[model samples]
Target chain A: YREFYQCDVDVIGSKSQVNELELVQIVDKVFGLLDVNVLVKINNRKVLTGFAEICGFPDKVVDITVAIDKLDKIGLESVEEEMREKGLTDGAIAVIEQILKLSGSTSEKLASMRSLMNGGSASGLVSETGLKGLDELEELFGLIDAAGVKCPVEIDLSLARGLNYYTGAIFEVKAVDFQIGSICGGGRYDNLTGIFGLPDMSGVGISFGADRIYDVLKGLDKFPKSLASSTTLLFACMGAEELRYVLPVAAALRSEGVSVEVYPEPSKLKKQFDYAEKKSIPFLSINGGNEAEAGTIQLKNLTTGEQKSFSKADISGMKAFMNM
Target chain B: YREFYQCDVDVIGSKSQVNELELVQIVDKVFGLLDVNVLVKINNRKVLTGFAEICGFPDKVVDITVAIDKLDKIGLESVEEEMREKGLTDGAIAVIEQILKLSGSTSEKLASMRSLMNGGSASGLVSETGLKGLDELEELFGLIDAAGVKCPVEIDLSLARGLNYYTGAIFEVKAVDFQIGSICGGGRYDNLTGIFGLPDMSGVGISFGADRIYDVLKGLDKFPKSLASSTTLLFACMGAEELRYVLPVAAALRSEGVSVEVYPEPSKLKKQFDYAEKKSIPFLSINGGNEAEAGTIQLKNLTTGEQKSFSKADISGMKAFMNM
Candidate 1:
């Protein structure tokens, strides 16, 4: 079997659209932390249901959404052709094209869709389900704005998420500047637990491709430099005597949450320093015979080339200095 | 397919006994963090080989060790019976029993076995390979003692690890007080990568069963109470107006590394507090109309029944207070 790994977050219970809004906030927070600019395309399935009804072929909702889902790949004309081949009339195809192509902010676009679904179009269409979808979108977008979600969000009418089995808000996230497919997506399911025997439990969830996110970070060079080193400091091994002296100090620093690596064997100071440098360790502690006799530690900031001395027993002070 | 998960750690490119020492230290550190008392059993395959030679059946090493490996479940008389059935002379079986049953400290046991294997017994046998194994074990144990591994370390003679494919420094870890299977085990392999075409590389490694460790932790009630709560603080949602008031404050606290959850919908004060209590959220932030007007937050520590007020914009101070 083909295998890969993806992180999934699922929230169970509650019919409140606030879960949807919170999911959008999660997308916003995640991308914000990763320094990735994103655009969240959101739509509701009820709106698509109303769209199918208004277009005079409610039974063909799956066909229409599946075709529309390919708009980015096959273009509008080909999507229309696909819909035409799926038994939709020219008039219905035109209505699909017009509504999905409506250009505005998420709120403005929902308003336009609401007007069209309310018989503003020449087809004299009116759909309560579609209007409800519009209302949900309006309220969700309001919550997102009030929460100050950082990413740009849009109402993409054609983003039916490929006939996804969602009953409420649908979400798809893409990196704004990266040339890749959707990095994250999820939607609301009216009966997420029905297959396992419980019914009518509404829930929303999202999953992001970890590999794509890693690629985006790598391609854009956004990974932190600190990640290159696992050890925050390296204590140079002078000999058995020095190792004994620094053993407790290293343990103290470790307990204080600093990752300290003590060189296992005595080696040339130059060799030890090179080992620390190659590993990108930020600090180096040297305890030779002199330091051992003097009962002090000679610490050097590898990055800044700053040197300082500390009492051998001042574990907390040494830790604080390294943190600084 | 049956499936499970275990974390594996492998260290490559070192032939020094220190690698074995480090692996033991890792076991010590992991169990130390888990608060489990464990005994680390260490042995070497070469030593087993030498024992077979000293037992007068150099060609029957696998059979002798295999029979001895079952000593725990099958008892000594049955093991000797099985060995005799496999063409081991009764004298050899007696020798195997004598050496494996040496009752002493690890060092004392090794010393007794060293004298016996050096032509002290009636078999008048000596094994260079077995001597090297003992030497390697001596160095590794010395390093472990010097490095001050916290867990008890022992040398086990009958620990053949079931015909395991290891070359040196075998290890198995068991909880001292828990009646469960071994939680961790591993050993050194002389040519780990030779199967994939890279040859002659030496490595020491260990794998601990995550499920078994979890079971031990759970059965012993060692899991931390802090693992129960994810949200550090829950803001009581009084209404849309109050939610808006706490939105930025929650964001600020979240940016300061505090987990902040804003109740999604307005509800009665008791209901909101019940939600916080159910989720184990320690801190509850209430910013009702009065607090909103006063530009302050009414924060209560649910666990301690302590209340404090902070200026709405002082996120750091609020974070520090929550941390305290």
Candidate 2:
């Protein structure tokens, strides 16, 4: 439900190297943070349009592309069957099957596409639109190489993204180690806002499927340990009077950027200690009549079971002791 | 859209001092951060129920409460009119008006409610349920005082929250200086999930109206300046070769927790610097043929307009220079 409209020409140009590198860098940083292997598959919608022209069904481009997008889930035969059901001729289906079977290094696939668009084997189907698509792909690959993106990428010719609004390059990211579908995707759209009466503004952006990414991370057990808890210290008082005495200390610690909580009412010692344990709080500050009257606080390292007493005035020292 | 099931009795108990203190502490911290004056109004649905019983129309409690919730928006006369239309007696409406007009300091209002419930002047309306509700309110106020909650509070008997599900304490937070509706509110719901077949579970929670809070902050110009841009550095290279050379440097900076971007296709110096300016990137690193051959980088501070050269190995120093 979130949308970004970028009208900056340098970054939103359909085939700009600046846009490509920025995207690759983002992919690199995201995967680097997740510590997950990913493959960034890229293709151009123009190429698909040219492909439909060469299939002799330029008018049925949307129908063909929609069916082709389900190839991954339904298999090639099912896609071919669906296209045929959509009124595509046997010749068009065969041409699509040949394109789907394309596999090799990115450059090798680009070369194959170039030959196909040059009318080397397919005559009367190659068009200037098809050639232009190949040229854009070649330039994109060159910039990707110059940018030195670490993630593996391929010129996935069969990747026909479902949306019909994309007018140029399309990008999709897949987790290499997980079976979840594309975790991120977006593409260039020339004049997407034109339909809203603001014409000639082009833009491109990517959206991470956050829920699916969460699922992937959870399934892989890749979440970082630091996200476990927000509370770091608990004040375990012994009585109502002790609680009142500890309130200012808790407030001071909180102001010093330490997450601190005071047990509201004095309960059983075991129950208070168990509360600290269950919350995984690393430090516990306890104060009773004796400590309160002495103007001091008893600090206990919950993890180490070490206890010490500090003067209440030594707030800075207590913060350092608790590593706040 | 978020649902939390709290089965722990200690934290979820509606009358528990621990739970009340925790909520008050949280409210204090949040309002402290927002730096806005707020009034935290508290009432118990049980108290409203008692009010209905005292009005001699226990069965019409829901109808009366719903109408009372719109008191602020439609004034007292309209509320009385609506109640009359809903079949309340003229005597009952007059009594309700007396209750609604009872307003003063929180303690003074609580005293007035006690006398009213004790049948001082309006006799034979007080019930055991009403007494119990008053006792709970007294205990909650005592706990709030001990917890040292900083926000102002009021005991307005007319404050009937709209929801019928709240069985105990209801809280509504309002910004004193802003015209927006409640910025946050929540209440205790007893056995809400019992309809789904699980019984005897109680929970209480508060939800901050984040969108309204954001609007308030924007209108007040209270957002921190650091939120303007996430990127701190931009590497402006001279060519594809320079981009390749700067890629690792950018990666290293990113690994060190600095947000950095490199000019993708090495355009004019002016264009790259313009990109940096537009993005609000504070630092720009330029390494052309001379600096590249010397294994050095020219860093420009966009904010201070200070330019200096640093050895390529001084990445740690560069990070320190940018205060990242």
Candidate 3:
């Protein structure tokens, strides 16, 4: 309801970390194609829950994640203050802070988080769930490395933005230069279909932020030039008889799969050319009394200002010229 | 709300008969492409009004045309009964019958109607509007003939189907063998925008009866086969490693504008093949452990049972085989 259009590319039925890598690669490829720089930040619900448990606040995972999600906006002090208000002691808060501040490459962050979780919390709580999520992250990053994803991927300990339904990897994509909020985001749901009376189906999905992507493409002026019009060639209407002479020829080129349009009226040459230019038609075929009488057409390349002659019957030749 | 969608192809600012001919030709081409046989029936409002005037019921043109429009379903006696109830004399009814029964080609029918209108009604009323509509119809058919429209075009004297705003040519297309009613219809409105306070701007438009055409296509089994999907090829997932082996290959083929899908699951070969068949994916790339290690792909043309081998790096060769 918050976004304009949400299309989930759901990779259902596989719990393999390969699916997680595929999602990362898709995020990379889509932004790469759009010429937008993006960072794919990933975290796991199990890992976040593990952090909460080792902090001796296992049942308060949601509260901890909600507060820390604001760490970037309100700063670490405010985040820790919110955690303390949720009934966390200073020792528990310090341990959680140490895990959140673990920064390095994906592998290095996973290693440090593993050692810190293994070191046990102030209340001596150990988290196997945290270790499991770290393993999944390591495998996902391994596959991502093998696939050579071009976009940057990050391990964000503070990301718990996906709805509480997600049981595994959580993905949040942000435009590096665009000021718009997350341009795309989704996560893994281990039992998404269980609420529908279907049990235990694991899926990973991502939704592209269609509205933000459009704004990004528009703001950046990255839309391909060819989408202006599919009209490959235009036949200028010089005279009624000339228009009559070229109709069949234009239809011929169209039948051969060349997009062709004939000026609807016998307007002035300047007007016809302007119309073609406005519609972004690349080539124009011009004919006058002499050419019509001789059964010939003068084809002009609007882009290059090159002119060539073709017999009125030569559809393939005209199409080849248009292609060239 | 009556039809699922009604898209009117409006040709504005052009009162030329060429535009009418183009509409007719487009109807012909669209129906031809859909593999549905259609009869393009044309009538002019002026000609209908002229008939009413010459019948001494110029003030009752709407009543007269409305009654006669039902003549095909209600029969001549019933239609004449309704006309008489609306205050037409026997003489006027006889003259109307004489004109309605005039059967011939478009040109011949136009000529006879012209003669009959010139002969005078019971009140000795003559209609130049009738002559003008007849003349326009003649020019329109002339263009249609010159363009060699493939579908049957008929001047239906009883046809007054389009709403009363039409000032010139009226069109209705019906499936030749289908039991349903008109599949497409429209007319020329000389002052369509006048009601909206934009006067004297004439336009010709036809709305394709999308719902009916879809039903017609379904009834006659006339829809094109390719519309079922845009996917050109599917890479079968035999195993995790094989799927990984083909992901980049699938991405490469996709970059070349080929619609390729790598089966998202490493299921049984039979299951993957069945999935391909169900999705109407034409060609499929298959690989097992041996093929994955050798960096080779076995491409299968599912429709033809032809299979070919290509190395993983030989994307162009694999694409060519798919094309073949």
| Candidate No. with top TM-score | 3
> Which model is ahead, 1 or 2, in terms of DockQ?
1
Residue-level lDDT of model 3, residues B226-245, one tens digit each, is 78877889887776567667
Docking class of 3: incorrect
Please state the error at residue A50 of candidate 3 in Å.
2.2
- Cα error, residue A203 of model 3, in Å, equals 4.3
For model 3, how many clashes? 0
Instruction: State which candidate has the highest DockQ.
Output: 1
Task: Give the TM-score of each candidate.
Answer: 0.78, 0.63, 0.83
lDDT of 1 by residue, B279-299 (tens): 889999988899889999888
The best candidate in terms of lDDT: 1
Rank candidates, DockQ, best first.
1, 3, 2
- For model 3, the DockQ equals 0.20
Fnat value of model 2: 0.29
Q: In angstroms, how far off is A75's CA in candidate 3?
A: 6.1
Give the winner by lDDT: 1 or 2.
1
